[model samples]
Target: MDLAMLLAVAGLAQTPAPAKLPLPVELPAVANATADPTCGNRPALAERATCVVSTQAGVEGVLQAYEAVFTPQGWLVADASGNVVIYMKRKPEGGCDAFQVLAFADGEMAAPAAPAYLAFATIPRDICQAADPNAAAPAQ
Candidate 1:
């Protein structure tokens, strides 16, 4: 390659990558989210990523608060039960990451001691499959 071409190639290689945007974390828990020391690599419950949070808020309060927080970010309430709401958001930029957040309020059991909440989010649905594609043999 010519000298100019070689220099251009090197410059391209050294070009700083786009600034890595901070990966969004669970919201704060002062009526917000407490930082999970695990840094959000939480376990899966019912085939979705999960996290437990402690809050003094009741079901209605939590529903209202989280709706305000997530709705502006384009997440929609996919499903809701009496004390639980499941919010889901697909990557709008056309990526495979689909997050479903399950927020449950259990004040009856956890009350008088500061109610606790559970939230499951950022789950990739493709991993929860019934058939094991990698298995080469049937169970004996």
Candidate 2:
């Protein structure tokens, strides 16, 4: 191979593979929404990683966009408390996993008209329930 072709091949070989996100789903294309690449790659069942979504759209718009992306992929709106929306999906192993999104507008934190933050956290337990016995409960 020529020097240029060899360099290109070396660069391709060095490129890192994309991390496997915990939810294994894609975010919706909201207007002016940009995601920080270092988030939502946690593979542990109990651990949660948050991907901040910087968007010019307001809080409502962010939530709507997430709902559109998550709903069709078998995720249901489990709860919406203030700026946070919890989406739950049933696991095939007789349990549930959840994606919790917390959206904040410009005025909520930092400067005015700042980027809206969409923090996503996934948990193995259903957030709709009052308690999760398997997680916090003492073993027999």
Candidate 3:
């Protein structure tokens, strides 16, 4: 290769890579909600991505809050039951990502006007499948 071409190649190799942005997993802000460390954190691929929040909205209200915020953002409701809901969305890089909410309100029974603890977790597609064999396979 020519001397100029070699120098250019070396410069390109030494150029610092662009800084990575924070993970796309974060809970939507809810009225009268605050972080609740009592639920602790769950580990993601790189770090703890689970967020436990305390709210007076109750379990049903928390579910509604998440549905309202995430549905418009392209998140699909994967599953919803009595006190738990899971939402899934296609990741920007590839595959699917899941956001799960588990509510523990007033010691198991969910009652309106009582304090509720909601655990929000972000799980990558690979981990999600490994954790549950029956889970739908991620899109290629």
lDDT of 2 by residue, 82-120 (tens): 555677777677556776665543332343354545556
User: What tens digits encode model 1's per-residue C-alpha lDDT throughout 1-140?
Assistant: 11121111112223343322222444545464553433123222322333545454443454466568777877676656543444555554533333444444332343423534444455434222313366355479
What would the TM-score be for candidate 2 when compared with the true structure? Answer: 0.57
Backbone clashes in model 1, listed as residue pairs? 28-32, 28-33, 29-32, 29-33
TM-score of each candidate?
0.43, 0.57, 0.54
The collision pairs in model 2 are: none
Error of 1 at 47 (Å): 12
In Å, residue 23's CA in model 2 sits off its true spot by 2.6
Number of clashes recorded per candidate: 4, 0, 0
Q: Which regions of candidate 1 are displaced past 4 Å?
A: 1-33, 36-52, 55-59, 82-84, 90-97, 103-114, 126-140
Better of 1 and 3 by TM-score: 3
- The lDDT per prediction is 0.42, 0.52, 0.51
Q: What does candidate 1 score on TM?
A: 0.43
Full-model lDDT, candidate 3: 0.51
Evaluate model 1: give its lDDT.
Answer: 0.42
